[model samples]
Target: MVSFLSCATQTHSLKPRAIITSALPYANGEIHLGHVASTYLPADVTTRFLKMNGVEAYYVCASDDFGTPILIQAEKEKKTPQEYVAHWNKRDYDDFTAFDICFDFFYRTSSPENIQFVRYVFEKLKQNGHIYETEIIQFYCKNDQKFLPDRYVVGVCPYCKAVDQYSDLCEKCGRVPEEIENPKCAICGQPPTKEKTTHYFFRLKNFGDQLTKWLEENEHLQKDVKKYVQNWISSGLIDWDITRDITWGVPIPGDESKVFYGWFDNHLAYISTVMKFLGDKGIDGREFWNSADIYHFIGKDIVYHHYLFLPAMRLGINQEYKLPDYIPTRGHLTLQSKKISKSRNWYIGLRDFLSHYPADYLRYYLVSINPYSQDDLNFDWDDFATRINSELIANVGNLVNRALGFTKKTFGTIPEPDDLDEKDKDAEMKIKTLLSEMTPLMEQNHLDRALKKVMEFSIYFNQYFQHKEPWKKGPGTNSCVYLSVNAVHAIALALSPFLPQSAQKIWVQLGMPGKTTDHPWSAISEIAIQPGHVLGEIAPIFVRVEDADIKARKEELGTK
Candidate 1:
């Protein structure tokens, strides 16, 4: 039995600053809509929101370039692994750009800086007596000149009888992996030979008691996450295999032949990428890394890795090397309730989606279906048309365009406001109160709920404008227009985090120079548009997503 000690640490500071990271995508495949919706987009949203609130938040992610799957794909194309990764790296960057994922620096794991940091941590683990070498039998593929790791070998699952099950687990049925009955190399399509090799292993079992104490004390985790982590810790722990016989990865600190496991080095890229990003900005990176507030946005598939392996790696290197503060995870993104299968070619690529619709259209839809719980989300083109047309075009777009269009046409600009009436005051109070209530939800990582509140404000303002008939010239008509104009201004401020392009359009239409991000979140409650301000050219920001386009897309995807 392991002896337990208190692992409680200080909480995050009250300041608005944060260091955010998303799950790293592997370099072997095209990044799909599901990936952006779950990982990178959420982090980008958080970073944007934090900066809007005057927070010094930083976000960094890279392409995971190691492991057997990468090598297998490269071999099939008769290209070097490095060439394959570099080719797809450009594609990933382009895809993210098309969707407006403004990462600080979208680097790759093949960089010298990443190798440097991985080696540093490896050395620390070695000196701290947190790593041990062990001889174990692993499946060897002679043609590939490397031992096959998990996700590279296949066998029959005894419990679920699922063929082509991966090592250490059955993904389809979640069976605890057992010894292989029929072993085959996933790449070469041949029987793999078993060979005994010496490899370094991280002493993950050593940190279990400390992890349990720390996890219980850490208040930032989702309640379900904490419960699952605690149950996992209570069950048991295992020493993790942290190195392998591979040539295309970060080498062990002192040995040049052995490579660090993808599990070990992949997560370190989060730290290494941050170091490279901040260090280039002429800022000391450690000041942020040492802080207690660090958040990771990942899909639920990697929960074991992030909650178990990552924290242990940090504690192995140094106690003060802050463990993660909050880990917000989401379920899988499915296409019409089916898993996205690359082999089947049944998924929509980011490029394909952007061809038919604008980036914000997808952004709004994805956030609406964001998996706050463990339930999966299906990307249905029909539903996408409905929401964009109804909630966005019919509601948000109509309101902004009508209010700004009337202002530009009627007064040639905004007019001086009269004294406030009871209804006008009440409308102002509602928007202010809702915006105030949303701040906490965003801070707590409940972005889905906070977004719902923001949309509620949009509808409230729409009704208020309609009830007063602000376009008609009459007594108190100027005050009605003033309230409607200020309401649109407030909506733009609240939207900067979610739909930045639309928000900036609203800002420029209001004749505000620069971008919407220049305005802070606190500005949403204050009256921004003064009377007699010359409004700029007004146009609709969002177009209605048509049913015909969605039907064509569904046909393209081989759906109804």
Candidate 2:
């Protein structure tokens, strides 16, 4: 008797569990399309694909409720910081819901749970000798009778000599301020007095060599991201500032008068988000936090915080806590070759975009351009309209409408093919090949290429259907109908990750029993649509966008 055991056929570097976190946008403003395009949308797409592939994945982000921006915005609006954050939190949450961003826990960072974790992590940092005392000269305005936050002061950037830049970072050159030159208070138009304040500093130099080694070792980081991190290491990472003289944030452990810097406390929210999600079910978040396959999808502006400061803090807190497996830091999402600016009213709100178009349409178009892989992509409305109308509607949606609509209206059920041709076999093979090819690209975050490949197949499927002319009653008409319907099924399954809403609608129209997303992702090309399957209700999956609507949007955004 043979006693050989079966070995599994799958190879995996990824574990069973996944956690995705987009960078928390500050609570001072509404969710804009650029934010959604760069971080949230791609993260949502990745989470959808991971879930579809049966990985236990969760997407989380919190409104960055603590920080200079919130306080400054509160003062400008003549409201308390807490009141301001509450209003914007609800607004942003509602906007995300409208845009169909399926976050597991889109909570606020200013919570009791986050405060506890901040304290705990700080204690560990102190114990591990990473925390130290320091004194900093921060800006103070006597008229306001308070220390000015980052956004309340304006100066020419010391690094790039750019005038009228915020004191925290340079807008033109992307430099974090070491010391501002010729600073003045913008709030009261007063020259600020420098006030000395005691602050906590993290001794990052101790971990410099370790961070360098790890950054060099991480293969999953984007090429430019890795280079940027390495350059940071080459420039000599200094002790990081971990305290701010403000009352709106988590206070330092010993002194209630002092608060942790927003950057420090904000990163802790990533952990708090996971903990909150797990805590709802009476589970400790530490177990998963200690070893889960973690990914951070953040904008390029905050690369220093996540790559250097965060991992060092995590290491200081616990050696067992898993280091980041992937950090897909995305560049800016621009409009007409300029960065999106809400201050200038030069960006679209997620709500405004949703009112004009379907959420999935934006999702598809964004992934097609894929702002992450390049420096940036312009959010051209003409491109948006043309891609959706020509590629999505005319090709993919058209294939489903013609194939399934004709089958249901004419035959009432899927017809068994009298004979399969070489073209049918080739189409089936191409579907299977796409399934294999797309998995690697998705795994590597090559979502743009994967999306392009799917559209390529959709174009081929439409051409095949047009060549066959399945509507006319003639010899092999039933066979043509059969092949066309199955090809539609193949396209729907393959597109489930990229355009889930349209995929589900098409799944129903194909007479499938459940949601398209519920089917196994690996079964996309492997499973065949059986003959005689009755069609479900037919409905339009996508609608054509008129040139007038896009023109109106351009005019509203002040674009030429």
Candidate 3:
């Protein structure tokens, strides 16, 4: 198979390569807007931006198919775990595709490739003395007739004292406790009795010094996140119990009664899925993965697993796959300033949202508001409509429609400009300057800022068009139309990564060949649309989000 290094050498210049991943969505549930806000949307935007900038980037994610939650839901539905996960996997992908979250390969953690890799990694860790077996007191759900692992047990977090926290991780504090306080069987809602069970544990505590060093050195990691993670290390790391008494997970090697923990196998899908994709193309997946910049985009909830467990596993296996270079974690999305709870019917599913509005509207609003931090974002319906109506439809949509619609009506084609005046020169310079400023913002993962900068570009052109009044048909009218049309072109390019569907519509109206992403991002700096270029059929790219529509959505959520 062709290796990445050899391929880079043959090209005479190595292109920037990246393997981007979002946290695997659980197979147990429908993906809600809350899920998209923090992880998938950001990862998709970053991957699209990198590709637009001529980087070789692949976005891979999988269904987290092997958790107790999946088994519980499957049993409730009277279906096998595989059958249940299969249904949600397809459903999740459909929802993601509708929202334009472009994952290159959306596989499953239960896939044969992943199962094999999980076993392989387990064997390697065992041989390297990073794994050991020990008997521990586990909660036995006698009423449910099973050992309560992970989601099957619930209690207050030992570290943060948050009630109703999962045994594995605390949602309120984002920390994993060695043991939860006041544990009860989630299935029976009764306190569970302790029973001795033999389980395998990974030497996660052994990698404390190494993990600390890596976290310190990796400048791309979020400082706020690192501060807490380092504190977790300083307090002392605990050995991770990697095996569970579950039948739905990856079967332990030569042990049919037990399986590898869900967290143990799920993140390994990141490597296995890449291998599956590239191996089909006759490429060395391992070499490519190790050589490229690895990014694991996640939400604040799973911080403990991705930050510690993921890297520790790779380290135990002698770094066969390199550690993540960047783990861009963002905070949760609240609905109308309240925590979105599915059981409460306060969550908007991706499919449900798409039925109400275009995908780009959601994409644009989320990226515009979500900063590159662990700060929680609220998806207020009023705020959503206001941004879409005032900013997206009014500022950006107005600019494109006026520029192209006016050009189509008056000129029917781009008009050649006369000698440049101070106003005309100043307008052109802003596009170039914004492109320069935006490069670093996107590169550094400040996507919210990058999108806001794009909006600022649109606002400037809107004001410039209003000031120039190309409708007056005066001396500078041709120059105004020329620069305005070109500005629309630049706007389309800038919006490609953020609002792809709208950007594509803008491209179609501009009579540009292929998709907006088909062009290099740098083309935004150029006056590419030549004089006399025939414009496509003129139309407004977006409709104003009506207030009545937002009110109806609020009513559905039982909000006044």
C-alpha local distance difference test of each model: 0.80, 0.80, 0.89
Residue 473 displacement in candidate 1 (angstroms): 2.3
- Quote the lDDT for 88 in model 1: 85
True-vs-predicted CA distance for residue 10, candidate 1, Å:
20
Stretches off by above 4 angstroms in model 1 are 1-16, 141-146, 156-163, 168-183, 188-193, 558-560
Candidate 2 vs 3: which has more TM-score: 3
Q: TM-score order of candidates, best first?
A: 3, 2, 1
Q: Estimate each model's TM-score.
A: 0.93, 0.94, 0.96
Deviation of model 3 at 353, angstroms: 0.9
lDDT of 1 by residue, 231-340 (tens): 76776777888887777889887778888888889888888888888898797787778762688999877787888889999998875457888788887899987888
Per-residue lDDT tens digits for candidate 2, residues 1-560, read 11111122222655667888999878887788889877888888887777777776788888889987677779889999989999988899889877778788887889888889888889888988889997788889998888886778898888778888777767666656676678889778898998898888889878888888888888887877777677767877778778878788998888999788787888889988889888886866778766677989987777777888888888787664678898887777898677787768888888888988998899988888874563676789999999999989988888888888989999898877767677766666776787787778788888888888888888887887777776677667777787778778878877877787788889888888877666666766664677778999998898999999988888998541
Q: What is the lDDT of candidate 1?
A: 0.80
List candidate 3 stretches off by more than 4 Å.
1-15, 558-560
lDDT of 3 by residue, 1-560 (tens): 11111111111122478899999999988999999999999998988877777667889889999978888788899999999999999999999988988888889999999999999999999999999999999999888888999988899998879999889889988888799999999888999999999999999999999999999999889999999999999999999998899888999997879999989999999999999988987989999999988999999989999999999999999999999999999998998899889888889888888999999999988998899999999998899999999999999999999999999999988999988799999998987787787878888889999888888998999999999998999889999999999999998988888888889899999999987877777787778999989988878899888889998998889431
Stretches of candidate 2 off by over 4 Å are: 1-11, 75-78, 473-475, 558-560
| Model 1 / residue 331 / CA error / Å | 1.0
From the highest lDDT down, the ranking of the candidates is 3, 2, 1
Identify the superior model by TM-score, candidate 1 or candidate 2: 2
Predicted structure 3, TM vs. truth: 0.96
Return the lDDT, model 3, position 284: 92
